[model samples]
Target chain A: MKPLYVIKIGGNVIDNSENLYHFLKDFTALDGYKILVHGGGKIATQISEQLGIEAKLVDGRRITDIETLRVVTMVYAGLINKNIVAQLQRFGTNAIGLTGADGNFIKAVKRPVKTIDYGFVGDLNNSSVNANNISNLMEAGFTPVFCALTHDGDGQMLNTNADTIASALAVALAKHYDTTLIYCFEKKGVLKDINDEDSLIREINPLRYEELKKEHIIHSGMLPKLDNAFTAIACGVKAVVIGKSDELGKLGNNEPFGTRLSKSNIS
Target chain B: MKPLYVIKIGGNVIDNSENLYHFLKDFTALDGYKILVHGGGKIATQISEQLGIEAKLVDGRRITDIETLRVVTMVYAGLINKNIVAQLQRFGTNAIGLTGADGNFIKAVKRPVKTIDYGFVGDLNNSSVNANNISNLMEAGFTPVFCALTHDGDGQMLNTNADTIASALAVALAKHYDTTLIYCFEKKGVLKDINDEDSLIREINPLRYEELKKEHIIHSGMLPKLDNAFTAIACGVKAVVIGKSDELGKLGNNEPFGTRLSKSNIS
Candidate 1:
């Protein structure tokens, strides 16, 4: 079997029809192995506002009250998952839509409550993810499209950050299939300076990352992404790359399109 | 091997301080249950509003975007789950907060992509909840609080409805152990009319429920709850009930304080 390529996409791509369509087209053109994990946070907020409901965020994370969780489930899993599956099918990508709760593929633990107790958020450390389902889907010639929400051990669903979900998935698939994990986002790659688009960090090591974090050189969002990338590498993933969505196919061909994180810098 | 009780909580329970404190007081008293599935919609919306993000809903569901999903996950599974766990612990109920993605339980299938797809939402059709996790926690005198998010066959995490997650869990647990799924909400029972709060329907059969759905009598949010009730029944769940959350302890003692859904209408 060809080496599987695991890709993590953000929720921004959910409504960006042209970008999604283009990415799917490129994704389908080159075929070896693939899985897509995406996020859908913006769309949910739109709906919440219409309903006169307020959204809360703590430290860059949305607080999942009861109604928000339900709304997101309906959109992320039922609607978005199916929607992506349909789009992939349109381009003959042989796609299958899924959430993390199915077949126990992606697992999580509830995040410890903060000062103002939210409802049900989770920590990546508290969860476990299984990739067998992805293997099964790939064996059946189907590309699995995943949403970010998984089951904690206690017979309930918990919302997970998409970046963390992708990293965990990459670790699972890497150990299972000896594949590469690629995370695509709005930016082309990790940059040293937010303002300087050309200051992309081509390679990242743990020591430098920690120094950068402490010095406030890396942006807040990049902190978690880097952590997840480190985790994927530590968990025996072959490689981790932070790049743009449209150029993911180039990643599989060993193109240095983004910041690369390897085992030495992680575990 | 005592029968497991799977409780499904509503988001409204956490809206206000008084309500939250009261709910914690009551739920903590009934902490001997095997699992707890919680909801969190209001929190996500609050954050979205603050961030200048508009909330969107389709077919009565919230659409999740990357940003919002992250916030909610951190809130629901991270913050809220912990709060419930901590409250239960304060009442001498050894509790462990968890999300559905833990232990590869409660997985979901993502919706295929299409026009106006629901973002980050999940379908509960595909799930493999780890009943042993809940059972073990119970055996160890720990209450495992479950958040509403299940895994699909792939590595992605998708959002799940609390009721749906609870129902699917009950079904999954029933195959191994006698499981009772309880859905707690503000209403005393399933009402015949939305306006007539007193017109409570104590019970409903699948056929009758379907007729109500077909005739558009059951109405919006109630639709999925009803579907979950029937699914639980069909999947061998010992019992299902819809009622107020404050009566959990009474219900725990098998006092039957809620609107019970049984196979037979009345003995």
Candidate 2:
């Protein structure tokens, strides 16, 4: 199987133009088939506020009301996604910007009405991710840039998490290609000391992950990210790395770059 | 060669929910490869007013400054495009929403500064539209829903005229398929009397078009539209129709549904 790179970049990287361009340059320089999944940054919130829409959140997850959905769709799918695709095109890469709604690429179910309804938010199903369309596009020499939006297959576009999208896409594409999922952000990697830059963990296994959680070292935002990374590894993705966006090539080449997540301690 | 339907709907139809859905049903019922080009409606102007951005216009055409460009991109690509695609999906038609930036499908050069500058507005070039990708996608069974946003191929998304996009795409796709370009607006057809619906002209040829212009019957907005239609017909689109959108199938079958533009009056 040919190698495919499925990289996810968070809002922190996207919000900073310098970081985004630097990361895009590195991303364009990489070899092999690639797909980019991106999140809506603070800009969405800023726009929402400007539009007089109050964002509601619970347990760190946004409640995607109708107005919020429109704002995110505008910012993420419109401004951010197109800008990235255009820039990549300028860099000589034929990039296609997409939401999961495009080509029925990803069909998600609106999160069930539970204790806290996430409104228009969607939870991806097992067969939701359509890898064949993406593989065909890549074979035809186009890189797909995806925004954090999906469809319910029944005429509804839903707000989705980019990390989950990256993992789901990696799992789906793993059937056709040797897929490596990378989560890139401002951080170098999972840090041992939250404030210390030099405390970057070289690699981690299932056991170490649990230990870190038990010791409260990986708290707050990094927890869910790491959790998503390990989930990707377990889903047959060839490799998973959480790292700085600019160092993606080094991470892919197995150099000392990011915190590589492994299913077991064998590696 | 398989027949391909490249349909364009005006902002009037799109702004009305019932009309848009009715039009989509008619669109999806037609049997063949298809692409939909849409115009951003009054909602853009409404949003711009709410956002407090002054819309600059010279002789009725918008001058797309950076802020105006963002607004159009948001309204056209984000809200309107996705809604149309989602609705089509509900009707069991696999639809992919697109801006010209997606897949580098349509490349344009920024309209030059002549007497007045149309900031961020683009002029389509001969080599601008990438029809091969659209053909590949249609062959794969996805109907592309195109927004009026195009790219300069140099990291800038430019506001483009949707009617122009429709004509350009029709001309480009004419090479691979027997393309039928349909321009759907609120009117029944190009009427002999503007206020009389029964005065619909069943057919138009280059000679009659010139006569219409000479008589002052076709003036203002209809002028550019007819000019573009004639250009498309000259460029080898198998047929061109300007009509009510709900009558697409009848138009396809030549059942006197719309004003059919012909290269010569012989037919």
- Highest TM-score: give the candidate number: 2
- Residue A240 alpha-carbon offset, candidate 1, angstroms: 1.1
Cα lDDT tens digits for candidate 2, B133-207? 878767766788899999988889998989889889999999999898988987888998989999898888999
Docking class of 1: incorrect
TM-score of each: 0.49, 0.94
lDDT of each: 0.67, 0.86
> What part of the reference interface contacts, as a 0 to 1 fraction, does candidate 2 reproduce?
0.70
The prediction achieving the highest lDDT against the true structure is 2
Model 1: CA > 4 A from native: A57-61, A125-127, A153-155, A205-220, A252-254, A264-267, B1-267
lDDT of residue A220 for candidate 2: 98
TM-score of chain A of each: 0.85, 0.92
Residue range with the least summed lDDT across 10 consecutive positions in model 1 chain A: A96-105
TM-score of 1: 0.49
Candidate 2 lDDT over residue span A7-41, tens digit each: 99988779999888888878888888899999988
Reference-based lDDT, residue A261, model 2:
83
Q: What is the number of backbone collisions in each predicted candidate, taken in the order shown?
A: 124, 0
Residue-wise lDDT of candidate 1 within A119-233, one digit each (tens)?
Answer: 6665565337656545754664556677777666454566777777777777777766867788877787888887776888787777777777888888677877788777777
